[model samples]
Target: MANVKFDHITVRYGSHTVLQDFSLDVESGKIVCLVGPSGCGKTTLVRALLGLNKPETGVITVGERCLFDAKKHVNVPAEKRNIGIVFQDYAVWPHMTVLENVSYPLKKQRRPKEEIRERVMHALEQVHMTEYARHLPNQLSGGQQQRVAIARALVVDSDVLVMDEPITNLDAKLREEMLLEIRMIQKRLNATILYITHDQQSALQLCDKMAIMQQDGTLCQYGTDEEIILHPANRFTFEFIGVSNFIPLRQAGSGLALDCGELIPYTGEVPPQAENGGFDLGVRPNDIVFDPASPLKARVDSRVFLGSEYNYFLSLGQKQIRVQQSMLDARTRGVAKEGETVGISFLNTRFYPTQKGEQTP
Candidate 1:
C-alpha cells in the first residue's frame, strides 16, 4: 500500500554509532525481510521508523509522507504515522478478550461503537479468528494469539506493517503455520510489510526480497532469495545466507589448488584474477559432488540419513566439509561408508579473499 524508505540514515547511541548512512526501500504492497545476525541494528532500524528512535541523520518516508527528515526538522509522532506494527511478543492484553484486543486501537481513536464492532469483526475475519473473538488470550492457542495481534494492526487500517520476529516464540510447526498465515493475510490485504528476523530459513521462505545486514550494522546485500543464494555479492553474503565451505587457496604450479591437506590440483576453470594468493574457495554443501575420477580426495567421517537427504561429513586434510545428497542421488551413486576414501570436486565454486572483514574479491 505504501513504499517505506530510509535514506542516508545514521543512528548513534551516545558515544557509539549503531548505523551509518544506512538505506533500504520496501516496495509498496510487498514483504521485504530484513535479516541479519543478532545485534545487527535490525530492531534499531525498526525503532527509528516507528518514531521510537531518532536517527542522527537521514530521511524516513512512507510513500509520499515525510515521517522524518533531519535537515527539514520534520519528525511525525508515532501514533500519527499510521504505520502498523506486530511486535514479537504479540502483546495482547491478558485481561481483554480477542474482540477487545483487536478493537483497542479504534477505541483509542474513539470511533463509534457500531463502527468499531463492524471493523473489529472484519479484521478478525481477515485472520480467520472471528469464531474465537470472545475468548481470552490464555484460552487461544499461540497461533490464535498471534492472529489477534495481526488483527489489531489491521484494525488501524495502516497500509504498511512492520512484523518484528512475530513467529520466533512459536514452535517449529506453529512457526510454519503462522508464516503461511502471515503470507496469506499480506496478499489479501496487499499490505506493504517489513518483516525483520535473524532466521534465514524463514526469511528465505517468506520474503519477496531479502536484505542481509552484517554484524557491523551495514547492509551487505539486498535482493530476491535466488539472487542472494546463487549470485552472492561477496563472501559475507555467501557465508551468511546459506551453508558454505571455505577452503584456503594457493598458487600450485601452473594451476590453482585447494589447500585441503595436500595440494590437490584444482582443474576447474578459474578466473584470470585468482592467479595471486590470499583467496579462499567457497562452495555450498549441495554443490560439493562425489566424482571418482577427480583427483581431490576426502575421507568420509560419517554419513547421516536425514529423511529427505543424506548428509556426509568429510575430512579434507584437517578441516571438514559437509555434503548433501538427495535420496535419488544416494541410490544412483551408492552410499559411501565411514572411513571410506572418496574423490570429491567442487561445482559452482567461488573465490574470495581470506582476509577477515573483507567482503569482496
Candidate 2:
C-alpha cells in the first residue's frame, strides 16, 4: 500500500485560483473522503491526484514516487502512475466481456497470458462477479457493471485507489451494499484510498478522516467524523457536513445569550483565530431534546416518518428548526400535526463566530 501527500498545492485556471495552498497526507491503508458542495474543487483534487490536472505550484507524492513537482518541473503521465481510479459512470466497454475488461490493464502492461487470466479471475472473484465473466457491459445490471469497474481497478493491484462518486447512480439499497463491499475489499487489500463524494452520509460512514471544502476552494475542516460533528471549526464547517440549527446569540456578561432568552454558560475562551464573539449556536437535530414542558416553545411546521425515526420541522418564529427522534412510541411518533406547539431544548451545542477568515454573514 502507498501513502499520498500534497505539499502546498495550488491549482489555477487562467487567472482564477481553483485550489489554494492545499496540503494533505493520507497514511497508507487509510481511507480519506473529500466532501463538499458542487464547485468546491473536489473533482479538481481528484484529477490532480490522477495526474490529469496539474497544479500551478505544488508537489504530489504517492508512496516513494513523486508524481508532480513544480520546482523540478516534473510531471508524471496518468498512464504510468499505476493508480486505480473508479469513475461515477462505470467506464466498461460495451463490446468486451467482463473478463476482457478486467484483464485490459494486464494486457497494457504486456503480462503473460497465463498470469493475466489468473489475476483477472481472482479480481472478479473478489467482487463476486466471477459467474458473470462472459457477460457484456450492456447485458449486466447497473450494480453489476460497477462491480466490473471495481474489478478492473483492482486487477492491477495498485497501491492507491481514487473513487469519484462511485455509487451516485446506484439505488439506495445497492449503494449501501456497495459501500460495505468496497470498504471490506479495501481493508482486505490494505489499499490507500481517496473517495470524493457529494453525499455527506457516505463520507461520514466510510471515511477514517473527512475533509470539507468550500466553493471558493478553501478547506473548511479536516478531522475524524466524530471530531467534526462534536466540534466544528467554523460556521461553514458545521452547516456543510450535516444538519445544524444556527441560533442567533448576543453577548451576555461573559457568556452568550440566545434569541430565545436562554443563557449559555460562559466559556471565557475562544479560538485565537476568531475575531468576533457570540455569533451563533450550532446544534445538531439529534442533540436537541423534544419535551412538552421545556422552556423553549416552537410550532411544528411539518413532519416526516423515516421508518425507525421521525423528523419534525419546527418553526421558532421565523427560524426553521429540525429535530429527529427515534420512534419509540408507535402511536405518538407520527402524531405531531402541523402547527402543533412543541417545546425544545438543546443537549449538545457549540458556539460559532459570525466571521472566520474571509467568511461573512
Using all chains and alpha carbons, the TM-scores for the candidates as numbered come to 0.95, 0.87
In the predicted model 2, the residue pairs found to clash are none
lDDT of 2 by residue, 1-361 (tens): 8999988899998998989999888889989998889888888988898889899899999999999999999899989988998999658889999999999999999999999999999999899999999998999988889989999999998879899999999999989888888898888888889999988999988999998887888888889999888778877788888898876665566554455434434343344432245466678888876767676778889989899878888887566888887776435533567778876777787766654452223
Candidate 2: segments with Cα more than 4 A from true spot? 250-278, 291-293, 327-339, 355-361
Model 1 poorest 10 in a row by lDDT: 352-361
Model 2 score (lDDT): 0.83
In order, how many clashes per candidate?
Answer: 1, 0
lDDT of 1 by residue, 210-311 (tens): 999999999999999999999999888899898998887887776677776677677776666777646888889999888899888899999999999989
Q: In model 1, where do residues sit more than 4 Å from their true spots?
A: 252-256, 261-263, 356-361
